[model samples]
Target chain A: MEVNEYNACVREWADALFRFACKCTGQASDAHDVVQNSFEVLWQKRKEVETGKAKAYLFQVAYRKSIDHYRKKVKITFAAPPEETYTPANPDLKKILDRALAQLDDQARALVLLKDYEGYRYEEIAQITDLTETQVKVYLHRARKILKEYLVSVENII
Target chain B: MISWENYEEYMMMHADGELKPAEAQELMAFLDANPTLKSEMALYDLTRLTPDESLTYHDKNSLLKPEPVKRVISFPKWRKYAIAAGIALLVFVSLFKYIDTNKNNARIAKTDTTKPIIPEPANNTSNKNEPQPQQEPKSIAATTVQPAKVTHATHHDIHPQITHNKQLANTKQNDNALVNNITPAAKATTEISSLPITTTKPLPSEIAMASPPMATIPAYEITPPAKPTKRSLIDRLPIDEANKRQLKTIAHITSGASRSVSKVKEEIDGNAITFNIKNNNIHISF
Candidate 1:
């Protein structure tokens, strides 16, 4: 891909990648950093990426960066928040949804987000997440079951 | 064909639109049988995380414009070496020019002795504080110190320092001749350093005269302390000053008949050594 094609990728995919990263990382700053790092990786390997697979390539990098960032944040939370260690009940639908998403482990949450938000196929998600197609299906199914159970608590859901 | 355990797989496939039409119809029949589980479809909504209307991409379109490329310039290693070498050459040239200028200045200062500094053509050519070494042959004092007394001593056992006076006399024969001409006394009383003519500094007018008498009085006082050894008897001889020069002879003589004689015989330029110890006489000549 050329510079213009990369710029087009940035313009078209930055928002989607940023949204996926934000949901995965639970922070705007971390999501922004993830998007920036993903795009930088894309720019470095632009020569190797096919023009048709730019979105997958971008999400692939962003997905990996988000997983790493999520692990680091989880480690930091464990180190810093001894007093606020208990999970407070979040009533708002959006906060509850975020909490439900946060409850999923890294690969399961990434699997569900790649499937639902980005509409990536099982094979494409497996390629992006570096997993087998069957593994993606099983993990996504588990993540959805968790989300359904969390939402079932509310009588009138948003 | 789907069992209760496979119901989740079917529902997930239905939610993902991956279920066949027949499987979808079966999944809807199962959901109709369990109406309370219908709200579980909320997983579909919960899974989709669309960006909020308030959220933006932090102006990603601005990134399409190229960032400015920074250029860094640096000098190479060879350039630094060249600069250092040029400075060294410049310093070397400046030092050379400075030394050459000093040499030229000293030469100009020396040759400026144009007039006859000593109006009477005196023995001391040390006027103007510059030694005039060239006015030796024609000076009145130049006729005194003989060439034989000033020949260089080359004996193997001789000390370089004791024989150094003969070397100085040979090199400055013109000045030394002036020293010898100061008195015909040729006396052992006056040492070479006590010469009145070579006194470069001021002295008392009476003692400064060409008077060996006062000098001989001190020599007489110092005589008792002198041992009467064979070296001293030779030292008392007037010809002792020539010992530093080429030895003319060593005569060892006795009135008795000859017992034995040991001589170092080497012939060079008519120099010879004759040891006649039987008569207690030894002659070594150069």
Candidate 2:
């Protein structure tokens, strides 16, 4: 891609890449680092990437960097009380969804973010996440099922 | 086509927005037929996450690149030619100056080598009463012959001779005034006849008889200065007039002789003299 086209990619997709990275890494600072690194990699490989494919290339690099970041961090125990014991007092849908998203693993969360937030097709998501189309579909489905189960819980719905 | 066994797959595809419109309609129809399963579709729909439009990479300006700069310099045709001509002129002048200097140095060396050595005249204070040899007259006659040894005397040799003649003239006037009162003409004639004629040229008898001699007539007044000493055509000129003639002679040997003389004169004058020889103009200032 030309320098102007790469800059256009920065203007157009930086936020979406950041959002995806934020959802994957669960930390705003790590997500910002991932976004910065992704764009840096895109600029380095601009000669090889087409202008149209810059967004996908950015997401791919962001996905790998986010995965690396996820691997390096000490695993946090996301232990929740039993579904019956939880209170359903929180009505903020965005907060509830964020809590629900935090329940999923890094790869599955990135798949969900790439699908729902960016609205990439299964094939495109597979290209970004480096998975087969069938695997992307299966993972996304499983992630969606988890989110549905969380939302459907009586404590979460109220 | 949408049965209970395959209903979940259609619902998942519907939530992911990957299902065809006809398949989605069929799944909705199957969901409506089973109201309990319609609640499951609501939960699937809720799984979709709306992006937070506010979240953005704030420092995106850092990623942008600027256009590369190009610099070029060009000169006009006339300016190029003018520069070339200036360089050519400077080189020509420098070469001419160098050749002129070398020629002047060589000419100065030649002139130095050929310079005549002026010998001191013989001692004048010998006994006058004692009979001297007939071949040699006294002091003045001996001094006259010394000029013959310097065959190539230049015009510079004349200054000392002129000064010597003036001194001799003064001495002769003083001696003649004193002696003319006391000595008679017949006594002076006897003394003149007694003096030896050393010169190769015979004295004219009529002139000797016609002349009224004093007790001491300077020998130069008697002999006519040894026929003025034979000299080269260049050396015959007076010193002031010979500069141009000498320059011309050196010019025949080296082309830049006149210019070299001018340069030498300028150095001697310490730039106090300005002599310019230009086309159709000669400028001189002091």
Candidate 3:
């Protein structure tokens, strides 16, 4: 793909990618960086990539970048992971949800996001997360069960 | 009939729309029968909506913020290509130089093993039966080739006439003339005359078979009368020039050899030269 065509696609997907990255990372600044860098990385490998799959490619790059950020942050601090984000504006519910989500592991949290928020099918989630289709289904089922259990307990606590 | 124990899977899959048509119908029937289960499913569905709203808020805020200054993704293509080419050229030139030097060394070694052949002058006699001079041409050539010997001959105390005459006679006279004139009777007479005197250095025994027969004329004698030798102005200039040229050639050879060795050593340290003893071949490259 040409640079202009790539830039056009970047322009097209930038907001959606930012939204997905924001959902994944929960930090506006980090989400913007993730979106920009994903597009930039896509542009670098633009010759080998197809224009039709560019959006999906951008999301994949953003996903990996967000995960890398989480891993790096985890190493430096033992605080709550970024994905289980709670904001001050909706402190009560946000705290409950954050507590619930944090109870699940990294892959479980990612699986929940990819499946529930992104509406990805087990097969698509498998492809995106580099898991087998069976593993995706199993992981998503287990993650949902864990979230459901946490949410029930959180409702009781709140 | 889905059990209550797996009821959450039914609710989640129903929410996800992953349940097959028949399975969805069964799940729907089950939820219709259980109002509490339907309410629980609704609450889980509510929790799912919150993340999306947060995501939209964050996304809008990010989009509202001014886009980042586009970072110039510098490729450095030219510098990369130039560096690659330079390394390739260095490796190529070093390898060629090494091979050429090795070939030259091999040739020199081969030449060193073979003895050099030197041609001796044959006797040209005016008499019917004249004896031949037996001189080893190889030794004569080796000794004659030494410039130091020529300088010594000119330096030592001796008859200047005799030495001058001797050098000339050696050049112009054949072996037969040298053999005849160097005999004691002929030499004494020749010395008395203003005529040039020639001397014959005795041949080594190995060369005696080829030497002229001992004439009753006393085979060899012509000692130059001792006198303080005058250093001639004529010989010095030519000898100095010859010495200078020899030194320059030696210096050139040494410098060339040293440069070649240094280039080879550089290639070795750089790991550019690979010798494959199994294949009996060498490959030098980047």
The best candidate in terms of lDDT: 2
lDDT of 1 by residue, B203-278 (tens): 1221223235444544312222345556645555677567823243343333122323221333222675565456
Candidate 3, A19-45: lDDT as tens digits: 666655657777778877887788688
Question: lDDT (0-100) at residue B56 of candidate 2?
Answer: 80
Clashing pairs in 2: none
What clash count goes with each model? 14, 0, 1
* Local distance difference test, each candidate: 0.62, 0.70, 0.60
User: Local error of candidate 2 at A103, Å?
Assistant: 0.6
Give the candidates in order of TM-score, highest first. 2, 1, 3
TM-score, predicted candidate 1 vs. hidden true structure: 0.44
Interface RMSD, one decimal, each candidate: 2.8, 1.1, 5.5
Which DockQ value does candidate 1 get? 0.25
What lDDT would candidate 3 get against the real structure? Answer: 0.60
TM per candidate comes to 0.44, 0.48, 0.42
Please give, as one word, the docking class of candidate 3.
incorrect
Once superposed on the true structure, which residue ranges of model 1 sit more than 4 Å away at CA? Answer: A74-95, A156-158, B33-53, B65-286
Tens-digit per-residue lDDT, B60-110, candidate 2: 888777745558778899999999999999999999999999999999999
Candidate 2 TM-score, C-alpha based:
0.48
Worst 10 residues of 2 chain A by lDDT: A77-86
Give, for candidate 1 chain B, the lowest lDDT window spanning 10 residues. Answer: B152-161
Model 3 pairs whose backbones collide: B134-B211
